[model samples]
Target: MLMFASSRVGSVSAGRISNWIGHRYTIVVASTIFLLGSVLMGYAHAYAVLMAGRCIAGVGVDFSLMIAPVYSPKISSPSSRGFLTSLPELCISFGILLGYISNYLFGKLSLKLGWRLMLGIATVPSLALALGVHRMPESPRWLVMQGRL
Candidate 1:
């Protein structure tokens, strides 16, 4: 529930963030935040810290969700826009599937490490995204809007 609420708030504010920083950077930022949350959750010794990590991760999720739909269209050619726009949803489904599988596999470990492994594993992907996003082109539309082009 806390995650849900935080995501809603993040979704509401993501447009402003995207406008200010551009979609590419927004994704990088979101991924970084997600990474932080994952690390926090993985190492958390207290309930409050765990919930806080969850909320932070929720915000990152919402930011990615909000930006991807808008960003995809801007980056795609008209002919490919429909297909590209669907990729985010598909990727999300894939991630969820992976998460379930990992949870099951990790659950076999000792209780102290099982959940931590499950949560901490997310940081790998988040770190990848944060590092890789810089190689991608910024949205042309966003660039134009920002008067950078």
Candidate 2:
């Protein structure tokens, strides 16, 4: 519930920030936040820390969701726009399926280690996103809007 609340708030803020700083940096920011959240959750010894981590991660999720749909169409050719726009949804579903599998596999470990490993594993993709965002082209529409192109 807290996650959902924070996410809703974050989505609005992310949209504004993306407009100001551009979507590329917004994605990097979100990925960095997600990495932080994963580390916090992984090392958490207290309930408060876990909740904090969850809130941060929720915000990151919202930021990504808010930006991607808007950004995708701008980068894709008209003929491919429909497929490209749907890719995010497909990836999200695949991620959920992967999460379920990871949960089951990690659950087999000792309780203390299992949960930590499960949460910490998220850092891999988050880190990849943070690094990869730098390599991606900024939305051409955004560049034009900003008079940079």
Candidate 3:
């Protein structure tokens, strides 16, 4: 519930953050936060720690979710805007499918190790996004908004 609740709050506030810091920075920040949360959850030994990690990861999830569609259209060519904008949702659905598969595979492992591995695996994509964001161009609209265009 904390995850869903935090996502609602984060989704609501994401636009303000992107407006202030721009899309690239927002994505990097979101991924970094998620990476931290994943690490915390993977290592968490207490219920409180697990909940805190879930809340943090939730915020990160929503921030990225809100910004990606908005950013995609800005960065792509006009001809590809629709397709590009849809990619985020497609990727999310794919990720969910992968999660289900991973859950099934991990479910066979010892209980403690299985859960931690599932949570810890999330850090891979978050870390990848954090590192890879530096290579992505900033949204042209955002650059205009910042007077950097």
Candidate 4:
């Protein structure tokens, strides 16, 4: 029962994540799926109710990934910065792995903490990154020397 719920959220999260970051239409589609899932979860009953939670959880996962790569270049520099910029996606993959590990190892946490916490954890880094991004300058930068000093 719980396993079904835990996995429900992870199922479609990948495809939605892929789509959401790529284009405007993708976001609309993702949002629609997310909204549908939220509605389903809210009023769910039977095994199917858990299923909707899964769907909602999956879309939440997508939301976590939606803006990650795009946030990279805007935060990084020209040389070696792309590597640093890649950290967002890198960390995302790592978090997925960690979540998998958690699910496998922490059965108690899964039952007690619930799937929502896992989804929230996945979102926190991205949310923090987004908040940090707002403080950044939206400008192209270069190393320049104005005077010999």
lDDT digits (tens) for residues 1-149 of candidate 3: 66788878879988999999999999998998889889999999999999899999988898898898888898889899889988998999999999999989999999989999999899999999999989999988888888986
lDDT of 4: 0.50
Residue 135 of model 4, lDDT score: 56
> Candidate 1 residues 1-149, lDDT tens each?
77788889879988999999999999998898889899999999999999999999988888888987888888889999999999989998999999999999999999999999999999998899899888888999888897888
TM-score for each model:
0.94, 0.95, 0.94, 0.44
lDDT of each: 0.90, 0.90, 0.90, 0.50
Q: For candidate 2, what is the lDDT?
A: 0.90
Clashes of each: 0, 0, 0, 1
Top of the candidates by TM-score: 2
lDDT of 4 by residue, 104-143 (tens): 6555564544544543343444344435545554322211
Say what the RMSD of model 3 is: 1.2
